[model samples]
Target: MATNILVTGASGFVGKNLSTFLQNKECKTNALSLRNENWKADFLKSVDAIIHLAGKAHDISNVSDSDEYYKINRDLTIELFNGFLNSDIKKFFYFSSVKAVADSVEGILTEDEVANPVTHYGKSKIEAERYILSQNLPEGKKVYIIRPCMIHGPGNKGNLNLLYKIVEKGLPWPLASFHNQRSFLGIDNLNYLIYEMLIKNDLQSGVYNFADDKALSTNELISTVNKALGKKAKLWKVSKGLIEKTAGLGDKLKLPLNSERLKKLTESYVVSNQKIKSALGIEKLPLSAEEGLIKTIKSFKKEK
Candidate 1:
């Protein structure tokens, strides 16, 4: 018997990949897009589990209305979970962002750390998480809230695309000398973790941070991109001071690479995946840092 899986945000990067992957694994998958009318009623059918991935993404430019984030993200979560309270589903998966826990973190990020999200996007997710945790689940019901760092895969359009653009242009890579360790979640790793979450009934019901097995640096990431492109990596040895100054100038000049992006380019933030690994009783997660990165870069090259 095929397990019935219902997924929201079916058209998104992670949701689209997850729905396709579930179907490929012989699960009866039904996807719901946010644009569809009366989606909740359409979603209340014979679903064995529900994966909630719909929400307003972090509007980096801060142009969206204040109420929009809460209404769509926080309010929608409350509405959906309330609906689930009446449904027959036994398992629920919510895709939250690491940003929900912290906008800027020091040292290795852990699940035990106190959450203090700085942006509207993160705050809204945190609100949703609190709502779900406050409710008592019916017997045999399990809920897993996943907070993953910057996720990148074959079709991702986030920060990964920026790197691809810089590398794809065959321009002299200006960030070669920059070094910073950051955690990333590959689409494959996320799929595998969700599968484990469904299978491991004994796993605790709480927030779980998902990420790749290894922490990788930005310079290292560029190397992988370069390898995939089959070109000699052109890393410039620009001094950090000069780069910072240039970025400062960019702040006023409205240049493409500004001070904020430079911080993202050279910041040390590593998310620990030990919790999920222990919960799944797995020795190692499937995708290594380099392998997943190279695959993502190669995918972009093929897309061009």
Candidate 2:
């Protein structure tokens, strides 16, 4: 039987892919926007599940206001969730980032860790998560708060795009000395998890962390991109002090290799997907981290 699904942020990278995937699975899908005034009356009664993906993303430029993050991410979510509670919706899937838990992960981040978001964007998401968890969900109603780390795929151009451009330009990776590992969620695997949550009757209402099974280093990521592009990798192991000084200068010159960018490039943010995998009764995701990244790199080449 085809399930009727309402997806917010349907035009976004994740939502666009998710909506298409749902339609391919023979599920009827509709998009709802927060800009509409009568969303509650219009969508609440019509869908079997609501996938809320619309929120103020973490702005890399740091230009967006703090209040704006709270208003859109936290306040809007509360309003929509309250409406969902009052309606006949069976499931609600909230797309929260792992940043909501920690700006920097010490080891493998799990659902059990105490959330201490650093940035305003992260704080706003945690606020929304708190609100959702605080609510007394009625019987037969399921709500999930998903925290995904560094989602990548064909249509999405995030930090991966910057890396892709650098690799395409044949620029030598200068920060090869910063040894670190980071987790990334492939859009295919993320789509698979969301679909599972939609169809599975056993997924309990709780927070789940989503990620690819394996964590990769920045060096490995560059190598993967090189392989995808059929180009030889050019990694330059510049001294840490020299790189730091250059990044300091770059910060003033508004260059790409700033302090923040360097941290993101080299930081080890290994998220644990064990809980979600166990809940879904799967040991591995459909796509590996490198495979998904390769697909994304291929898309970048196609664009050029």
Candidate 3:
């Protein structure tokens, strides 16, 4: 029998990429939007597994309503997870974020962390995680709440696109000297990990951190983008202090390049993949820091 896998947040970045990816694996997949309120419980009844990708993301501008944090991220997850628990599903995969663990960790992020999130978005996700872990799920049930870093892929229009626009315009990549090593979740790697979970039922059920085997500096990322576009890589050595001061003014003026975004652009966030890679029994997926990024940046050239 073909395994039925139901995915939520079908219209979003990861889902759109994963749908096309699974077809290459010959997996039977069905997708539904979270905004689809009329969707019935029967719609999920026969599915072998559920990958819940729907949630409210962190708003960097801090413009979201105070109450809305719980409404979508926390409340909707419990509602969906309860439905899955009661149904015939054996495996449930929920896409959580590393921010739920901490805004910044001392070293690579681990599942054992106490989970101290600084924002309402992270707080809501942590609440959902608490609810899911608290349940005494059935003996055969397996739940995986995966926390992934920034996911990038083709057709993705995000902060990456914004960066691409800056570089493409020959802006001389101003943050060349600002060294940072942030983890990136390639769509291929994330999809492959979830596929392994669907196939390997005997694997332990718990929270997992998903990311590329290697972490890349923001400067390395710019070089990759430049290579993909076949353009000259021109990066300027502007002082980090000056950048931060300018960022502060930008924040006050509501300019495009602000202090918080500057921090995000230059923060070092490295996630360890030891636990997950060992569980899956795979060396690594085919995505490299440069290779995956090249494809993503190449998409912008055609658009321009």
| CA lDDT of every candidate | 0.84, 0.91, 0.84
Model 2, range 1-304, lDDT digits (tens) per residue? 2289999999899999999999999998899988888776677476799899999989967998889999999999999999899888889999999999999989889999999999999999999999999999999999999999999899777888877888999999988999999999999999999988888987899999999999999999999999999999998998999988888999999996888778878889999999999998988998889999999999988886
Q: Name the lDDT value of residue 184 in candidate 2.
A: 93
Q: Show the lowest summed lDDT stretch of 10 residues, model 2.
A: 38-47
Tell me the alpha-carbon RMSD of every candidate: 1.8, 1.5, 1.9
Native-to-model Cα distance after best TM-score fit, residue 185 in candidate 2, in Å: 1.1
TM-score of 3: 0.93
Which is the winner by lDDT between candidate 2 and candidate 3? 2
1-304, model 3: which lDDT tens digit per residue? Answer: 2278888887788887787777678877898666778755446666788888988878978999957989989998898898877877888888889999899867778888899999999999999999999998998889999999888877775778877887788878999979889888878888888878788868888999998889988888888888888888888989988988899999999997898788888889998887899998888777876788888788767776
- What is the TM-score of each predicted model, taking all chains together? 0.94, 0.96, 0.93
What lDDT does model 3 reach? 0.84
Which parts of model 1 are misplaced by more than 4 Å?
43-45
lDDT by residue for model 1 (1-304), tens: 2278888898889888888888777777788666666877776567888889999998888898878889988998888888787888888888888899998778899999899999889999999999999999998778889999988899775788877787788877777677778898889998888877766668778889999988888877777788888877778879988999999999999998789988978888899999988888997888887888888888887877
Candidate number of the best TM-score: 2
Candidate 3's C-alpha runs over 4 A off are 249-256
Clashing pairs in 2: none
